[model samples]
Target: MSTHVVVGVDGSVPATEAVEWAAADARRRGLDLRLVHVGPQWLHEGDAGHCARALEEAAGRARAVADGVKVTTEVLSGNVVEELIRESAAADALVLGSRGLGGFAGMMVGSVSLAVAGHAAGPVVVVRTAGAAGAAGASGHGTVVVGHDGSDDSRAAMEYAVEQARARHARLHVVSAWQLPVFSPYAVAYSGLVEDVVREEQAAARERVTPWRQANPDLVITDEQPCAHPVSALMDAAATADLVVVGSRGRGGFASAVLGSVGHGVLHHVTCPVAVVRPRQEDRA
Candidate 1:
């Protein structure tokens, strides 16, 4: 495991907010903080001073959040996604703003943040502006949500979620959302069968978390298997969450999507800070 947290900094409001969140998390995890500024090769040719200033200012913001934390800054010249992905390989977690200016700029959650979340190793946290909750950062809501669908990735997500809950002394909610498979128009006769399958799925979902609950007897762990879309179920749970976590991929509704359909949707919709945890290389298979 790495000993520090790396945050992409571009001096945008969202990026600044991300620095704050990353710094706080670094302190909580007893890790150092590193501020990174990445830009295209062409931009770097003429923006040397600007890059330094951006990194310096971001480092200051990070220091303000945790004065005792050691902070460092670096300027990289290359494709934003590629450099950040490389950075993620050696960091405990890679943090980025949901949207940014300059190199990190885009609409809504932004393409860069989503792309990195999909490919980065370890955990990639996308911290959005305070739009949904009128404030950003982990606001001590005392709840953390994670989406699990019995896949390896989901299992990894649960591990990360459990650690986060323990760190914050928050509740952990594992959500498994399911839906009936598409049937032919004349398949109404299979209604009873559909109900049976739904019940089975719900039971399996609950069973998946049973071991976790038993092992962490002191921690408040809860599991919900709802007959609904994964994104909707997670969003509903996130409405009162301080942080929401999801894996890079999963089964069923999530499929093996780059970031998993559910994870991508949650990042765009969840009000709380979101963490996308990718399983280690050995566990990817």
Candidate 2:
């Protein structure tokens, strides 16, 4: 079956860019592209016609970029995030503009992108606009980075990242980070404590990637140790990578609810596109 990539659009410039990117990707991979637009019920009643026209225009732009790729568009009336989550479940992958019409300035990503990354059943990519400063990286193909922490969610993310790397024929960079607990000064002050801690964590990370590397010898693996912030380290690496993949939640944060801080932080700060993957609830539990 042809891979189906679903891109969420809200008639914004970023959304248009995402459509173009998705179109090019779909064409290159011999896949199908689905463009989805969701808005409030009032917008649907007041501006549904305009929304339809916008989708047509976006579709035209996508076709112009990569002709012959099967493109489909849909405008749904409901909560934007919920609709996107539902549609994404049926697709092999989901793509969205990093920020949309409604979002706070401090926020690196729009709420819709955050919601999808946090909850989508499959892999979700947040595409940044080209006009943004310091955003462009290695052309269509470059290094793909996946953040792993030995959790099931991170394992799932690694699986998706490996598949994407293979599909794009790009190098894969797997990252895992460890930091001393800030709340415990005693641990930091102890002699050789930090070194010992880092060594153990790095060892664990290497162990985690061992099987994956054995299975795919071609994958380029880079293990890193970012001070105390996983988010900052991931964002720094993502700036140079073609794609950054991370799990929606990790071991340290709120496990039963929304996305953790690192995932949320990367969503906002990374210059390159990011993919957030979540495993099934049973798997997570």
Candidate 3:
């Protein structure tokens, strides 16, 4: 299939970093890189060439970093998030920087990143700052971290994570989190049963991943069953990772509420690029 990676870049430091990351990623995957800049109507009246200038600068920056990759540029006029979502429908992935405004009520976590990741028809990656993802060429670097649970949504996430690890020759860290329900009717009775519940949950997670681990024998894999919240575990893993991967929605909990509050936390709070994977349109049907 025809595919390329689309990175939305504005003329900001974070956006520039995203362009570099996208270009590198595109080169690594042998795909084309498209730099997109969206401007409002007011920009046309005040500074018609603003979008052009931004795209030109971003394309040049990406070309410098990934010299051999095919690069293209685009300028769109309209609602930023809506236009991006539309653009993502035909791309392999939609990438965005970590910087965004808070003028809208629902744009809690870097508006465009969170909204597009939740509702887009494909994977949406929010690129983080360089320091947040650790220093360059350091030891124990560039691990691909993923949050996995025994859910179909999480399976898709793991699939993407494995592909990333294989492509980059990086270790895959699969983390599963467990927590006792605070509002259970037996809350008081099971106050001391948290460990028991966690053990069972960890076993289930391991069982789910066994087949995948056996299939990819050459890839280094680690299964972490942490007795903490999934977000907490994933964020900790992201601290020293090149990429953090997670499902667009999970089984039924904070993770399942990706379109709203939890989405903000996962995408905004993480220190590395976070890939929120969703099912393809054909698979969903």
Candidate 4:
């Protein structure tokens, strides 16, 4: 694994928030913090200087917030999303603002942020703006939420979430949302069958985390298996969480697809910082 945390900088308020979040994470993980600003291809002389100042300012803010972390600055000129994805290949995690300067008004998630999160090699964290996040994004709640569905991808996300919760000395909330199969509208007297399915799903969800709970006896872990949509369950959990984590793709996702629908949906709606983690390259095989 890389020994540094990389965050994209664009001198926007949301970017500043992302820098603060990444800096604190770098401090916690004892990794170097790299502040990267990607300039457009048609960069003029004046624009180059402005990019430099933005990097410098971002670096200073990183140092102010995370004193011990080693911070570095880089200004790259290329396609913003492509360059950041390349950076993520060699970093522990890539952090970005929920939206950047190029973002349209009233847009919650920028195209760049979503594109990088979908294609990045490692974990990608999109930090929402304070005003946009509202109360859910406010003071730390000492709780980290993760979505799980007994899939390999979810297991990877769970591992990452466990490490984060342990580092923060916070509780881990494992949420598994399951839906019952739809029966024919004309069918009748299936109450017992519906009840049986619910019980089985609840049990399976609970069983999947039993080992994690037992293994980390000292770490407080809670499991929530709700009969609802995955996004809804996760959003409810993230309402008072410090962070919410989800795998890049889940079980039923297409093998060629990098980001799953649930992961993408949460990124657009979740009020807290969202981490989209993909299984390691080696593990995917």
**Which tens-of-lDDT digit does each residue in 258-280 have in candidate 1?**
45367778888886789898887
After superposing candidate 3 on the true structure, give the runs of residues whose Cα lies further than 4 Å from its correct spot: 41-46, 100-110, 131-140, 183-195, 252-257
lDDT scores of the candidates, listed in order: 0.82, 0.72, 0.74, 0.80
Q: State residue 185's C-alpha deviation in candidate 1, in Å.
A: 5.7
| Per-residue lDDT over 208-259 for candidate 3, one digit per residue giving the tens place of the 0 to 100 score | 7798889999899988887777677777887778888888877633355365
Model 4: per-residue Cα lDDT over 1-285, one tens digit each: 689999999888888888988888888778999998888778788888988888899899889888978999988888887899999998989998887663112224747777788788888998985743312223478898998876777888888899888877789999888777899877778878999998988888899899999888888999989887788788899898888998877752212224546777788788788998877687789
For all predicted structures, in order, the TM-scores are: 0.91, 0.84, 0.87, 0.91
lDDT by residue (tens digit), candidate 2, 94-158: 88887665221122375667867887877788888573321221254477888887777888888
For candidate 1, the lDDT comes to: 0.82
Clashes per candidate (backbone, < 3 Å): 0, 0, 0, 0
* Model 1: residues with Cα > 4 Å off, grouped in runs: 42-46, 107-110, 131-139, 184-188
Ranking by TM-score: 1, 4, 3, 2
User: Relative to the unseen true structure, what is the C-alpha lDDT of residue 2 in candidate 1, on a scale of 0 to 100?
Assistant: 86
Clashing pairs for predicted structure model 4, backbone only: none
Error of 2 at 43 (Å): 6.1
Candidate 2 structure, TM-score to reference: 0.84
Leading candidate by lDDT: 1
